[model samples]
Target: MIYQIYPRSFQDSGDDGVGDLRGITARLPYVASLGVGAVWLSPIFTSPMRDFGYDVADYCDIDPLFGTLDDFDALVAEAHRLGLKVMLDYVPNHTSSDHAWFRESLTGKESGKRDWYVWRDPAQDGGVPNNWKSFFGGPAWTLDEASGQYYLHQFLPSQPDLNWRNPAVRAAMFDVLRFWMRRGVDGFRVDVIWLLAEDEDFRDEPVNPDWKPGDVEHASLDHIHTQDQPETHEYIREMRRVLDEFDDRMMVGEIYLPVVKLLPYAGTAEEPMVHLPFNFHLILQGWTAELVRGFADSYDAECRLRHSWPNWVLGNHDQHRFKSRLGADQYRVAQTLLLTLRGTPTVYYGDEIGMTDVDVPADRLVDPAALQQPDSPEAGRDPERTPMQWDATANAGFAPGGATPWLPLADDYPAVNVAAQDGDPASDLNYFRALTRLRAEYPALVGGAYRSLETPGADVFAYERMPEHGGGERVVVLLNFGGEAADVAGLAGGDTLLSSLGDRPERGAALRPHEARILRG
Candidate 1:
C-alpha cells in the first residue's frame, strides 16, 4: 500500500506552524505501523506557494518551509530503516516563474534559456495563441509584458509550462530526478505526465459540447492541442529509462486519460514507460457499485493485456474526501473496495480515520485556484487538505502548543483521530489497519487474481481473490452500499475473518447498513 502525504498539512515540527521533514521523520513509526509499503509525498520542493509546491522553484533542494537538505536526508534514512520506500512528486510540466531558469528565459528572446519554456507571439488580434484553456481557469497563455510574448501555463500564471522540445531543458530535468534518486528517493510520482508535450502547431481546441453550468470552465473546451499529445510518450520513455537505472524502483504517472490512452504508459514489464499509471476512474465513477466494479474490471483486463501492474486511489489532495463523496456510512465499505481490488492500493493520509471534507470558510481560503474562481468547487483543495487528525490536542497534535496550523483543523478532530482509534477495534482506523495487515499476510488478497462473485442485491459489490498458485483460503469481500443491512443468506457461509461491523453471528452473517466484510472459506 502507498500513502500520499501532503507536506504542508501532515505534521508540524517547528514554530513556523507548517509540516516539516522532521515532522514526517517523527511520524515514520506511525506510517510503518499502518502497514504501508511506501509513501508518495506531494510536491515538497522549493516553491513560491502559488500552486503550492507544484510550482517548483528549485527541483534539487528542499524548500525552506519544509526544512533543509539535511532534514530530508534524515527522513529518508529513517524511512529506509523502517523498511519503507520513499517516493517524491516530480512536476515536469511547469515551474514557478520565479525559478531561475524561467527568470533567465524572461531576460530576452535571444537568451540560451529562452526556448526552455513554451512562449509564442500573440495572435493578430492581440489574443492568446489559441483557444486553449488552463486547467485551473482562464486561457492557458500568460502575457509576458517584458518579452512581448505569451507563455503557456496549463495551471496558474505563476507556473509556466516547460518546453520539453529543448534538449537542454530535458537534460536538466532528468538531472533533477537523478539528484533525488541519489538522495535515496526510491521512486517518483510524476505530476501531469501527459501534459509534457503539446501539439507542435499552435491551434484552437474544439469547443466541448458537453459543458454544463457547474463544471469547471476548462471543461468547456477539449484539450486537443494542449494535452496527451503523441510526443509525451517519448518523454515518458525517457523518464522510465532513468528509473530503470535503480534496482526495484518504480514510477507512477499522473495521467488522467481514458484506459486506452493510459495503458500505453505502462509498457511491457520488460520495458515500461511508467510502472503504474494512476487509476482515478474509481473516484470519477462516483459511489455506484456497478459503475465502480465495471471500471475496475475493464482496467484490470486492459492492464493484463499490456502486461503491467495496476494501482488504485480513492482520494487525493486535489479531490473531495472519499467519505464526503461516498457518504459517511460507506467509509469502511470504500476502504474494502480499494484494498481488495487486485492492484497496489493507495490510501490518502487520514483516510483511515474516516475523515470527511471540512468546508474552508472564504476568509481562510489559501488555494490560488479557489481565489481565482470563487464559485468552482474544484478550486479549493484546502477542504480535504486540513491538518492530520493525530489526537485531541489543541491543534489536533499537528502542531505544538500555541502554534496554529497553516490550514484550519477539522471540527471532528476531537472525536476522530489516530490516537483515539488506533487501539479501538471498532474504529475505522483499526479496520484499515486490519485490512492492510491482511493484505500483507494473505497471498489471496495481495497478488491474487480477482474474480467477481454474484451478490443478492444491487446495493452490494462482491468479489473473490484467488491465490495465484491456488489452494489458499479464497478470500471473498462483500461490501454493502445500501442503507439497509444485507443478509448473508445469499452469500456463501464462511468463517468471519474481518467485518466493518464490530459484531456478527458466527454463521449467516448479515452485514449491517453500509458494512464491509472479508470472509475466507
Candidate 2:
C-alpha cells in the first residue's frame, strides 16, 4: 500500500500554486485509482526552499519548484504506466546550505570539500560543540563566520549535517540512489534514516530523565549523541547495498525508533536493511483500543522476533490529522487500523478522504518548525502540510483561481473533497475505495499472520489475518475504539467483509459505535 505524496501539496501543474512533476503526472490517474502499490514522492530534489524540500540543493537536478528533468521523466513515465510505483523523498540526512556540496564545504579550512560538512572547533566555552539541540530550535551548532568553524545543523540552519563518515558522502548518496533507480524509482522513503550516523566521539547527549516543563527543545536531550549510531547500522547496510542494485528496488527507512530500535532497520536477515523500518508506532501512540492492542501485540511480537517485515503508518507529512487526531468518529477507526495491519501500509495524502488539520493562521505560517517554535505544541507543520483536497473549486482544487496556496484550504474543503468523496458511497472517499478493494481481494490481507484476537473488553481491538503458509480465508479485524457499544462475541463463523459504518453483521457480531468490522473466517 504505500501512498505518501506531499510534493508541494500534491497537484498543481503550472497553474502554479506549487505542486509539480506535471502535477504528479496529472495525478497519475488519481494515483492509479487508489489501490496503491507505491507512490511516496515528498521532495522533488534541487531545493533551497529551506526546509520545504527538506533542504536538498540538487542531488541530480529537478526542482524548478518541482518540474523539469523532463518533468521527472514524465513522472516516471506516468508512474510506470499506471500500475504505479514511484517513491522518492530520499533526503539522506541533510545537504543544501545551498549545496554545491554545501557550497564546496563553505570554501575555507583548505577546502577539499572541507571534510564535506559537520565541521567543529568552537567548544572550550566559546559555545556549541555539543549540547546539541536544533531539531528546529536553538543550537545544533552553526557559527561558521568566515570558516572559524561550527556547522552541524540537525534540522535547519539551512540544513548542513552530512558527512556520513564521508566516503565521499557515501559515494554521493549511493549516486542519489542510482539516479532514482535509473529513473524508474520503485522505492525509497529514507529522509532522516536515523540521521545517517552521528556521535563519532562528539558526545554530550544524556539529559532527558523524562524532560517535562512543556517539552520540545529536541525533547531536552537524551538523543544519545544525535540518534541511533553504531555507524547507523553500517549506513543502513550501505543503503541496503544500494537498493540491492536495482531490480524491484525497496528502501523505506524514516525511522523514529522503538520497536526495539525499529527492528535493526530490518537488517541481519543475512544483512538486509530498510525494506521497511518505518513503523512509527501508529504515529507515536495513544489512540486507545487498549493502546492499539498493546501496540499491535508488541509490534507483531517484535516483527516475528526479527525476521522483520512489518510496517504501518497512519498519517504523515509529520503529525496531527489522524482525522485531526482521532475525531470525525475515529476516521473509520483509523482507516480500519491502517488497512488491517500486519505489515506494509503508509497511506497519507489527504488520508483516504477524511483530511483535517488546516488551521495555520498568524498570517499563513509557513513552517520552519512553525517559524522556529511559534509557541511549540510540537512546532507547527503548517497544519499538516495543507493542499491536495482536489475538488470544491478555488484553491481547494489546490491551485490556479489566482494561485496562492502554499498552504491553506481546509475549511472542510467543501464537504471534504476528492470530488465530494467520489460521489459518496458512504464517503471517506468511498470508504477508501472499499478499503483498497478490501486490500486487493484479500490473500488474508496480502500476506497475513498477525494474531491478537480475544477482545471482549478494553474497547475492542481484535485481530486475526492468518494465511502466511496455510489455506486462505481467515480475516477477523473488529476495531471499535470506544464510543461505547462493542460486543464482538468472538465469532468463529465468517462473512461480514468490511464495515466501519457500512455494516452487514450477523453470526455473533455487535460493534456499532465507533465500528470497524472485516471478518472472513
Candidate 3:
C-alpha cells in the first residue's frame, strides 16, 4: 500500500501552523508502521499558494512553509532507513505565473523564452483564442497585453500551461525530474500527464451534447482538444525513458480518462510509459457491490492484457474522503475491498483513522474552488484536506496549543485521532494495520491474480486471489455493502484471516452490515 501525505495538513514540527518536511520526517516511523511500501507526498514545492502548491514557482525548492531541501534530504534518509520508499508529486502541465521561466517568457514577444508557454493571438472578435473554458470557471485564455497575445491556462489564470511541444520546455522539465531523483526520491506521481499535450492545430473542442446549464462551466465543452490528445503518447513515452534511466524508479500518471483511453497511458508491450496510470474507479465508481466488482474485474483484465500493473485509489486531496462519500457504514467494507483487490492500493492521509469530511465554515473557507462557487454542492476539497488527527491533544497535535492550523482541525478529532484508534483493537486504524500486514505476508493477496466470485446477494461482493499457477495458499475477500447481514454462498473454506467487525468468522461467513472479511486456505 502507498500513503498520500498532503504536507500542509500532515504535521507541524515548527508550530508555524503549517506542516513541513521536518514534520514529515518526524512522522516517518508512524507511516512505516502502517506497512505501506511508499509514501507519496503531495506537492510541497515553492509556490504562491494560488491553487495551493499546484501552482509551482520553483520545481526544485521546498516551500519555506514546508521546510528546506536539507530537511527533505533528512526525510528521505529516515524513510529509507525505515525501509520505505519516497515519492514526490510532480506537476508538469502548468507553472506559476511567478516562475522565473514564465516571468521571462511574458517579458515580450521577442524574448528568448517567449515560446516556452502556449501563447496565441486573439481571435478576430478580440476574445479568448477559442471557446475553451478554464476548469476554475472562466475563459481558458488570459490576455497578456504586453506581448499582444493570450496565454492558455487550463485551470487558474495564474497557472499558465507550459508548451511541452517546445523542445526547450521539455528539457527543462526533464532536469527538474533529475533534481529530485538525485535527492533520493524513488518515484514521481505526475500530475495531469495527459494534459501535457494538446491538439497541435489548436482546434476548438466540440460542445458536449449532454451538458446542462447547471454543470461546471468547463464541462460545457467536450474538451476534445484540451485533453487526452493523441500526441500525449509520445510525451508519456519520453517521460518513461527519463524515469527508466534510474534503477527501480517509478512513474505514475494522474489520468481521468475512460479505461479504453487510459490504456495508452500504460503504453504498449514494446513502448512502456507510466508504471501506473492511477486507476481511480474506486473513487468514481458507484458505491455498490456489482458496480465495484465490475470496476475491479474490468480494470484488472485490461491491465493484464497490456502486461501493466494496476493501482487503486479510494480518495485523494482533490476528491471527497471515501468514508464521507460512501457513508460511515460502508467505510470498513471499502477498506477491505481496496486492500484485497489486486494491484497497488493508495491510502489517503487520515483514512487509516476513519476520518470523515469536515465542514469548512463559510468564514474560514480557504480553498479557491470553494470560494469561487460558495453555493455549489461540491464546492471545494477543503473538507478532505483537513489536518491529520495524530493525537487527542490540542489542535489534534498538528499545531501548537495557541497556533491555528492552515486548515481547521476536524470536529471529531478528539475521538478519532490516531492515538485513540491505535489503542483500540476494533478501530479502523487497527483493522487497516491487520489488512496491510496480511497483504505483505501473502503473495496471493499481493501479486497473485484476481477473479470475482459470485455471491448469493447483490450487496455482497466476493472475490478470490490465488497464485497464477495454482498450489500454495489463496485468499478469499468478501465485502457486504447492504445494511443487513449477508450469508454469502460459495465462499471458499478457509480460516478467517481478518474481519472488519472484529469477529473471525469461518467459511461461508454471515457478515454484519457493511462488514468485510479475508479468509486464507
Candidate 4:
C-alpha cells in the first residue's frame, strides 16, 4: 500500500505552522508502523505557493517552505532506512510562471526559450484563441503585453502550460527525473499526465450541453482538444521509458478519465506506460455496494484483459475525506474495501484515524478554487487538506509550540486523533492497523486474482481473493453497506479473522449494520 502525504499539512518540525520535509522524516516510523510499503509526497519542489506546490518554480530544488535539498536527501535516506519507498508528486504539465524557463520565454518572441511554454497569437476577433477555459476560471489564455502573445494555463494564470511537443522541454523534464532517481527516489505520482499534450491545430472544444451556470467554468465545454489527446499517450510512453531507466522505479498517472480511456495509460505489455493509471472510480462513484462492486469487478476485468496491474484509491488531497462522505458508521467498511481490493491501494493521510473535512469559514478560505467560484456545488478542497491530527494537544500536535497551522484542525481532533485511537483496540486507527496486518500476512491479497462473489442482497458487497497457484489460502471479504443487519450465508464455515467492529462475530452470526469482515477457510 502507498500512503500519500501532503507535506505542508503532514507535520511541522520547525514550529513554523507548516509541515516540512524534516517533519515527515520524523514521522517515518509512525508511517512504517501502519504497514504501508511506500510514501507518496505531494510536491515539495520549489514553487511560488500559487496553487501550493503544484505550480513549481524550480523542478530540481526543494521549496524553502518545506526545507532545503539536503533535508530532502535526509528524508529519502530515512524513508529508505525504514523500508518505505519515496514517490514524489511530478507536476510535468505546467511550471510556475516564475519558473526561469517561463520567465525567459516571457522576455521576448526572439528569446532562445521562447517556445518553452505554449504561446499563441490572439484570435482574429481579439478573443481567446480557442473555447478553452482555465480550471480556475476565465479563459485559459493569458496575454503578455510585452510579447503581444497569449500563453495557455489550464489551471491558474500563474501556472503556465509547458510545450511538451518541444523536444528540449521533454529532455529537460527527463533530466529532472534522472536527478531525483539518482538521489534514490523510487517512483512518481504524475500530475495531470494527460495534459502533457494538446491539439496541435488548436481547435475549439465542443460545448458541453449538460453544463449550466454556477458550475465551474472549465466544465462549460468538452475538453476534447485540451485533454486525453492521442499525442498524450506517446508522451506517457516517453515518461515510461524514463522510469524504465531506473530499476524497480514506477509511475502512476493521475488521469481523470474513465476506465476505457484510463486503460491505455497502462500501455501494452511489451512497452508499458505508467505502472498504474490511478483508478479513481472508487472516489468518484456514489457510495453503494452495487455501484462499488460493479466498478471493482469491471476494473479488475479490464486490467486483466490488458495484462496490466490494477490499483484503487479511497481519498486524496483534492477530494473530500471519505469519512465525511461515507459517514462514521461506514468508516471500517471503506477501510476494509481499500485494503482488500484486487490491486495496489493508496491510503490518504489521516483517513486511518477517521478524519473528516474541517470546516473553513470564508475568513479563513485560502484555496484558489473556493475563492474563484464561491457558489459552486463543491466549494473547495481546503477542508480536506487540513493538518494531520496526531494527538489532543494544541493544534492537534500538528504544529508544536502553540503555532497555528496553515489550515484549521478538525473540531473533533481531541477524540479523533491517532494518539486517542492508537490505544483503543476498537478505534479506527487500530482497525486500519489490523487491516494492513491482514494484507501483509495473506499472500492471497498480494498477487491473487479478484473474484466478485454473489451476495444475498444488494446491500452487501462480497468478494474473494483466490490464491495465485490455486492451492493456497483464499481470502473472502464481505461488506454490509446498508443501515440494517445482513445475514450473509455460507460464511459460517470460514474462520472469522478480523471484523470492522473489533469483535469477531460468532460463527454464522448476522453482520451488524455497515460491518465488514475478513474470513479464511
| lDDT winner | 4
| Model 4 bad stretches (over 4 Å) | 377-379
**What are the TM-scores, per candidate, against the unseen true structure?**
0.98, 0.36, 0.98, 0.99
Error of 1 at 394 (Å): 0.7
lDDT score for residue 249 of model 2: 89
- Candidate 2 residue pairs in backbone clash: none
User: How large is the C-alpha RMSD of every model relative to the true structure?
Assistant: 1.3, 20.3, 1.2, 1.0
Per-candidate clashes, comma-separated? 0, 0, 0, 0
Q: Report how far residue 417 has shifted in candidate 1, in Å.
A: 1.1
lDDT value for model 1: 0.87
lDDT tens per residue, model 3, 1-521 = 78999999998888788888888898999999999999999999999998889999999998988888899999999999999999999999999999999999988999888899999999999988888888778798999987679999998889999999998998999989999999999999999898988788888889888977656777788898889977788888988888888999998899998998887798877899998998887887688888988888898899888888988889999999999999989998888888888899989999988999988888878888777655464858899999999988899999854579988888889999989888888888999999889987888988898998888888988888999887668888888899998776468478888888898876765777888888885
Candidate 4 lDDT score at position 183 = 94
**Tens digit of per-residue lDDT, candidate 2, span 1-521:** 88888888888867768888787788779878878888888887878787788888887887788778887888788788888888888888888888887888788889888887889998898877878898888888888889777989888788888888989888888998998788788888888888777888898888888877656788888887788888889978988888888788888888787788878878887888888888877877788888888888888887888888888887898787788788888888888888878788988888888888987788888788877876676777878888888888788777855688787788878778888889778888888888889878887787888888777778887888888888867888888878888667655357788787875878676787888888777
Residue 3, candidate 1: C-alpha displacement in angstroms = 0.6
Q: What shift in Å separates residue 219 of candidate 1 from its native position after superposition?
A: 0.9
Candidate closer to the true structure by lDDT (higher is better), 3 or 4 = 4
lDDT of 4: 0.91
Ranking by lDDT: 4, 3, 1, 2
